[model samples]
Target: MGKKNVSGWSTIIMLLTAAALFTGCSASAGSKPSAELHEKTMHWDKMPEMTIDLDKSYTAKFTTSMGDFTVKLYAEDSPITVNNFVFLAKQGFYDGLTFHRIMETFMIQGGDPKGNGTGTPGYSIPDELDTELKYEPGIVAMANTGKPNSGGSQFFISTGKDSENLNQMPNYTIFGKVTEGMDTVLAIAKTPVKETKPIEPVIIEKVVIVQS
Candidate 1:
């Protein structure tokens, strides 16, 4: 009778181990990949282009490690650029990314998944330049590689008086403006940097968009 009891307990323990292993595997398979993993295995070819109404306005609230700031997008003025930004924000593409470029008294630039200036959303969009709209202080605009229609995910927020000069070269697309949190924008601009890159990374926690 004692021998039979031991054998039954051994069988139960083996069954429980197998069940635990299966549960672990299932949980791992169902979990979403981390941002680091996604970056390594990113396939830009599958990224879809979004369409947004031009008549409506969209506001994006950015919660960064430095502070929070709100940007009011100019959809009517830059429909394609605004739509692209909205799509990326909703998809959580900008989360955990850092503002790689910072220019004191100029602007703070970010939106690269690689935490460097060269990353993109697997695609580039055409320029939506409007001569009527100037790059004044607190203005948010897309960062391009000087080539026409080279705007990608990177963008910069104007800081000091020098930003107005950006208007002379109508290459960057003016998409939004910082309606609130100018102080936070200025604080980010003041962060120490080595050349254009920041010494200590200012992480973007998340971006939320509200349609208006």
Candidate 2:
């Protein structure tokens, strides 16, 4: 995948960079917030379905017919977002999850409890589209409608080089990059989709955060 779509770590890095500047520093938990993360994670928002993990190198295990894959997260960059994900991963919020939306040459979207692609974790965060990160393949990014800062859990990965039109608006936080099983992601991306959307939903067996 040459990365024709922009959604992944590229977006989050940019957001975090800008957030740092705006907040007078990076988004750090003040004096260690609640570790009472979620024991189970529901769809996006709605409290992450688990407790928050402020700092840590987390891994998410994704099991699919294509195979099982893992991804690590950077809490330092986006604490609340990362914690929510981590909480959900631990709770297996994504266990029965499906890649609801798969647009060929664009991106694959998932993480909505509604499963139809529209759902939130209850609250939305401010926009964090920092320029430090650029749209690149294998990068993980959040999904949102025309609304800015409306990204919840609904996220996508760039199978190929996404257009810079994403830069048109400073939104959608990209947080992590798939370090392994990239071929698996590519294989999923190669699947046939109706009207450029996946005809068969790519379900996520579970999301387990990996430690490296």
Candidate 3:
């Protein structure tokens, strides 16, 4: 009787082990691919040809390591900036890029190909600033070198409501705003950082453009 009991317990243990292995394999197969698997970064000789229809409304959905956020593009108000952004988003230029700068309670900046403060898309676009737009929280704007017509691929999203400081320096082009998932943007803003850079990488996994 004792021998039979021992044999039954051994069978139970083997079945449990097999189940665990199968679960592990399934999870591994279904998981999203790591950022390293994507090779979408490339330099363009000039700005991409404008293909966005001004009449249609557009939005960009960014999938990141922390979470997802959606930005509504102000195409009519900032056509050039919106067009360039849309082109890059469709081309997958922003994928796998890290959010290099983070100013707590202020903003989070990304879209730099170099994953640092000094990368551009091999070209620059003229600033498309509107006097009416305010640099309030959830506002998305282009990052530039504090020079005229120096706007490029880098962009930032405002996380704080206090814009008296940004309003004073009114250079970042206001092309979009976070229409959904501001929580994700704030979450990223709260990431631990050193020297204004996130200690651990917060990658832009992908950016999907939606036109209506």
Candidate 4:
């Protein structure tokens, strides 16, 4: 299926504005005093040791609270990103984490241990961007801070036509694309959010990876 047309430049602009506003709200929440206290109360140093065979194909089956979906990792196009994601999945790093950032007609982001956008995997990985990979809906990619090779465990799934523009900016690492259960993804995307965060937590039950 093709991406839905978002009307025109004006609608696209409005979507972009909403996205920006959501990001800003998330940022502000992370910086709040209560959020700082929450950070201090919780230990964020847990990182798993993992390994991956770069020679094989990997597919991740995500069983989420909303439903199940599968993404096929592009090992050849994004070796490092795929490897890291596979490793994390095997280690159950994504279990119970909430999709914290949800912008309708944009993307749903998660994989942060903190359930906040600011959390990381205690380290960053180098970017593996492929010019050939466009950010179409169902494209799974790493989320970064616009800095070089700063991707961690945080990632997002493209949900709208605007992702085509995201393809133009090659900052985020494109690692995989959802091959099944996109209907579940779209359902999750329609969830209501306040300050870019889902009003109710959408939990990731587990991530199961299979090698081929």
Q: What would the per-residue lDDT of candidate 2 be over residues 99-209, giving only the tens digit for each residue?
A: 766654555666755455445555555455653666567767666654666555667776765423455343567677778888888888788877544677677777767
Question: Could you tell me which 10 consecutive residues in candidate 3 have the lowest summed lDDT?
Answer: 20-29
Ranking by TM-score: 4, 3, 1, 2
Error of 3 at 50 (Å): 1.9
Clashing pairs in 3: none
Comparing 1 and 2 on lDDT, the stronger one? 1
The estimated TM-scores of all candidates read 0.78, 0.70, 0.79, 0.80
Which residues of candidate 4, in runs, are more than 4 Å off? Answer: 1-50
lDDT score of model 1?
0.72
Residue 46 displacement in candidate 4 (angstroms) = 12
Each candidate's root-mean-square deviation in Å?
22.3, 10.9, 20.8, 5.3
Q: Rate the local accuracy (lDDT) of all candidates.
A: 0.72, 0.58, 0.75, 0.74
Ranking by lDDT: 3, 4, 1, 2
lDDT (10s digit) by residue, model 3, range 41-72: 57787887788999899999999999999999
Q: Per-residue alpha-carbon lDDT of model 1 for 1-212, expressed as tens digits? A: 01232356655643432221111112221244445422322425433565676666789999999999999998888888898899888888888888777777667888865554556676678888754787788998887655677666778888886665454445678999999999999999899888767788898899999986
The alpha-carbon deviation from the true structure for residue 70 of candidate 1, after best TM-score superposition, in angstroms, is 0.2
How high a TM-score does candidate 4 get?
Answer: 0.80
Residue 84 CA error for candidate 4 (Å)? 0.6
